[model samples]
Target chain A: MTGLNNKIHQALQQIHAEQALKDKTKAALKQKIQQYEKQKYKTEKRRLVAILACLCLLLIGGAGWFYFTPATTISIDINPSLEVGVNFFDRVVSVESYNDDGQELAASLDIRFMTYAQAIQEILETENITDLLSADEILTISVIGSDEQRCRRILSDIESYTAGQKNIYCYSAASDEVATAHEIGLSYGKYRAFLELQSLDPDITPEELQHMTMREIRDLIDSLSGNKQNENASDTHQGAGNGHGQNSGGGNRRQGR
Target chain B: MRSEQEVNKAIERYADTVRRLCMIYLKNETDTEDIFQTVFLKYVVSSVSFENEEHEKAWLIRVTINACKDVLKRFFRSHTISLNELMEQPEILEPDHTEVLEAVLSLPLKYKDVVYLHYYEGYTAPQISRILRKNVNTVYTLLTRSRQLLKEKLGGDGLE
Candidate 1:
């Protein structure tokens, strides 16, 4: 068995040795290996990109949660004050005050889970606001940890509430426009008017402009510029509708066209 | 994964062995070439760390056999060219060893596989059993039956 197996082995070896793999086949095999390597690299890179994209999405979601969240604390200071802490749904969580007058007012008012607008109206009615805000006094309204849009909307609401009242100017500290104007040594109301007047007629009298609100001065400027009854009557109406800060000048500054 | 240079070296060393195994199992050039490529491509893509060159060789043999089996299962078995026909074909098998080679090829696949691994590859029965995933007793039985068949086909005389 051993002798015959050896001879058959030798014969098969001769047969095996005689046939060689063609050069083309060897080259094709190498090419296949190279292709496989490239495919593996691409798969690895795609996996890494997918992981990074998920991480980036997580980071953006976290930042957005931190930035655009609505405020929990709506601080209304008619000095005698009112501070209300609310949730994202605008339900009042707690109401507290630092001063004795504010404490007394906070105790008297029941603003729990009340919408901020309702709470403000309730506080105004509950407190003797006339005594709290006497002549030569301003009310400061600030919202903490909130986006600008919500803060400005709430500020506008409060400002409208105090509009016809005597000796009350609302300072909306959270408003960007208001804060930037205050930084530049002008109240938000006056600065807004300055911008409007400057855009309308650059040479409009900027003198004693500080004493006028946006609407009073815009109306004064409209009467003086004589463009109020012009062909663009809709534009004039739009301006009147959106006017902010109405300060009464000494009289009217409508000097005539 | 094997590097390009490492893969190239492996192809150089083992391409002929794979071809020989395929040739022994299948007689068609197309089938042989198909299995040859599959075996090498699988080696390139496999992440298995071989213990040594012998282990790698055994892996290639086993994969080539499995790949051939898969192809056999996938397609209807075409009639393989008989060794008598191969011997008659010009410039195919050398005339001197064609008789013994034909005798080996004429056996059944089960017997021929053990014959090739034992005689040409020089593996022991235990080693053949491991490579072919058969019992050692089964491998020894197949080898003995194959020898008897080869001797009977070759007129009961060993090749000179």
Candidate 2:
């Protein structure tokens, strides 16, 4: 029995030794291959990277022209009043100021819009706006809703019609209704009409109203009513028929044109 | 200087990856050595640089696997060994454990590759896809089929 136990122990030891040999051989062979690769690789591939670096630099330099081209500097080079006097019909819808090196520094707008009167009694006392057709200071504006919710449909019209195979970038006055009402230059009626019509739009929010530029609202309302060029006729017609079933005839006219 | 030193250390760290990949393809020590050299040589030749140590480790593992396949194809045409003999050689180390490992080795090469990478090398099915350039679904299917075969090779009454 002791001899049999001894034999079993010997067999186990032999198995363990064989396993150790198997593992070592496998590990050594892998190490030797890695050593050979490490020795040859460094010597062979040294110059490849410098060449790649140079190629990368050339590509980046070529791309910088688009990223860093001087912005189109379209400012009022003289006093805007003088520029306007010299070119009256130019209308100077947008003014872009430039730096000494001709990079666009800032953009300003000097388009004509209505003079606003305060709303009736409460509009006059609480918020006294004297010259309804007057100038207001503006920093920046866009044709999209100020909060990025909805835009005047006329933006698409301008892109499709006005841009017409030409790719020049300009800040347009959007639709005829907005521009015409803006140019009418009287505040109370336009503002009142804007409030009345704005209330009628299903999706209009007071937040959208507060952020809206006079020009953007004018464009949106006019485009919705469908007479950008005929704001005076439409505003008067809308005012006269407001809140009565009498406007039902005009509702038919809305679909007619 | 620190990054370069880290990269070299990272290559040394993923040494098991090269071993398991070689073990899946080649039967003997000499063939494993050849595969190891080829995989690292690929790492040296690759123009793509990595962001950190982890990236370098992953690239080393993937390159080793491809090199192992290439070496096996180049060799199998010239030298043929029975699958049973190849599977039995590792028995000298652990006769008790040889059943599972041998069953794995006897699987078809597509199933064997996915099993080895998934189990021994610790790659997830998604990582296996990038390494083998196979779809993720294909790797999952191969793994499931291979496991079923292994269960059968173990020869139990489970498949009723």
Candidate 3:
């Protein structure tokens, strides 16, 4: 009888689980849509602001090289490159570059915390930036934290993964981690970090993960997320970021070069 | 008397339970998740005052069920179902009898609701009545009739 009961039980339970997972996926998709919409909204507002600012300037128009204005660029040369941590909850990254010419270039940010698939999907296929970005889309390109999950990355039990190390995880670019709609949300960066660690230390035993704090394991993983030598500004995602967000402030800004 | 710690603990402990319940009630994936989100959101917003931990949990469950009911209505009206299907097993569960499961899903939403709460969740008839706000007699009768129909459809032994 228990066996018979078990059959019905499993079916219903399976259905229940399926529904929840499906719900999570759909909610995430919807969240991404909303984020994109918001980015557009912010961009529109900024454009309007620029237009208003320009109109006032035009009203008092002057025709000289000094009067003509190019974009503002202030090159903040960060020395001793800072390693900002991308934790398990971060979703987006943006970079701002300024040169002496007052010309500003919003360089590509370190967004490698995102899966190649997801990055492709968002950067290429998707058009709505508002939903993917925040209302405070740094116009001058503040260093974007695409994979906030990296900062919060944890070393899961070794038995959980294929090899040895825990995976880097990131939350959705679609939803706000601090203000998500669902009780549970996806960690895209930490999740991938988990996988990548396993691949590196395929023989990483489970016992090594039993008692250590996440902060401790992050020490070992700080060198593996990307090539240590890829220091160009456009190459932010190519190296393992140190576990300190603030310490890397100056150096992270240089990642856009 | 639950302290602040106890309230937090209860939320952590029963999170899985509420998630499972929402899933069972709202068969559609989006509906189940939306219900779960609404439950937690309302819980967080309403935490301004609380008598005890039980009150908090009860509030969460009641809101979850009500929210699930709301989602089911919207889903039936919109008729958009089966988006990104993935199963979430409880800590431990039994094997699925596919035919029987199909027969069960085919029942009217009301009958299906009662059946899931009873068999899947292992709730009593009275419990189902309370959850659904139906009379116990009505719940009991629905169970019997639904079980009979299920047995007839799936050639079951018909004993619950």
Candidate 4:
């Protein structure tokens, strides 16, 4: 067996793999490796594209939220009571109507995306508003917001724009007061008048006042307060002589006639 | 995956041992080529780190043995080959060495690996057990049986 083991070792020693076999294997391995690298690169590129697509969607969604969110509200109250929501860029983002007449006016007007000043000028030039102003009907504009400085700036701009107009009033009120006004289905301007009327005539209901124009509410408040005798004296002053202050919880009336 | 340089070095180092194992298990050159490609490809893709050259050699031996077994177990394989076809360089071997190699290859499949690993490779029973993943006593029994079979086939003139 020992001699046989020696013979076996010498015999096996003569059997080595040919150089041709090793060359063939190396060529096959190189080809397979190249294919593997190409497959890996394609998979990585697909993953990168998916990530970029998700990032673009997130950026577009964020920009949409920033552009559409309202930062303040401007309520224009007359026979047509409605509010225009203004974004941080001073553009009108929304217009919400509180009455049938307001809804008609809102439907007829295309004031969205316009600057607040342009929207207000558009509203004042409308036939309904021009006719009402000539007939001595009162138009009240209220600026509603959480930021005091922005509200004051908006109110000053509004007052300057309507300086020559008669029977128009502007004021600033806080967001909490506007929230209370919305609860009873009223614009902030009409809600302020309701509060004044409720103080003078405790029997005056919001339901009764909802259909009434701003002039009618003012006359009812004057008759209830016994100030009808001073009505002509108040009308003599065009856009001055009305109380304009920072009203934290109520209307700071900027102009009245 | 291993670099081409590393794979080349491994092929140069272990090709002989692998060829010997392939000859002992699979007698045909086609099956030997299959086992060669499979075993080297496995080495290229494997991430296992070796502690020493001996460890790497043992791993290659174990992989080659398993690859040969898988080829042999295939249902469509042509299992028979003459001794002349089996030897790539039959003209180089003397008659005595040819007789010894024939006797070694004629053993049953179970005894061939133990005989080759023990006699030619000089692996102990315990080392063969570790390489083949079998019990030490089983390796010892296989070695003793294979020696008895070889002695029976060849004359006992130079037997231990």
lDDT, candidate 4, at A120: 98
The C-alpha stretches of model 4 lying farther than 4 A from their native spots are A1-11, A87-90, A135-156, A166-257, B27-36, B47-66, B73-75, B78-82, B88-97, B103-160
- Which candidate leads the pack in DockQ? 4
DockQ scores for all predicted structures? 0.21, 0.04, 0.11, 0.57
Candidate 1 chain B weakest ten by summed lDDT: B76-85
Candidate 4 per-residue C-alpha lDDT over A1-257 given as tens digits, one digit per residue, 9 for 90 to 100: 46767877887777778787778777777676677678878988988999998998998998878888888899998989989999999999999999999999999999999999999999989999889878778888889999889999998899888877777878888898899999999999899999999998888788888889998998988888898768656765653433343476554454333
Cα TM-score of candidate 4: 0.74
| Tens digit per residue, CA lDDT, model 4, B1-160 | 8877888899889988998888878857678778878998899889999999999999999999999889889844534334686555654356657777788878888998898898899999999999999999999999999988988988767777
Runs in model 2 deviating more than 4 A are: A1-257, B1-11, B52-54, B77-92, B156-160
Candidate order by decreasing TM-score = 4, 1, 2, 3
TM-score of chain A of each: 0.39, 0.20, 0.18, 0.81
Q: What ranges in model 3 sit over 4 Å off? A: A1-4, A15-257, B1-12, B25-28, B47-61, B78-95, B157-160
Better of 3 and 4 by DockQ: 4
lDDT per residue (tens digit) for residues B25-138 in model 1: 676767776776677778877999999999999998889888877877778664244776566555546677777777776677678678878888889999999999999999
Interface RMSD for candidates 1 onward, in order: 3.2, 12.6, 7.1, 1.7
Error at A11, model 1, angstroms: 1.9
TM-score of predicted structure 1: 0.57
Return whichever of 1 and 2 wins on TM-score: 1
DockQ of 2: 0.04
| Higher-scoring candidate on lDDT, 3 or 4 | 4
How many steric overlaps are in each model, in order?
Answer: 1, 14, 59, 1
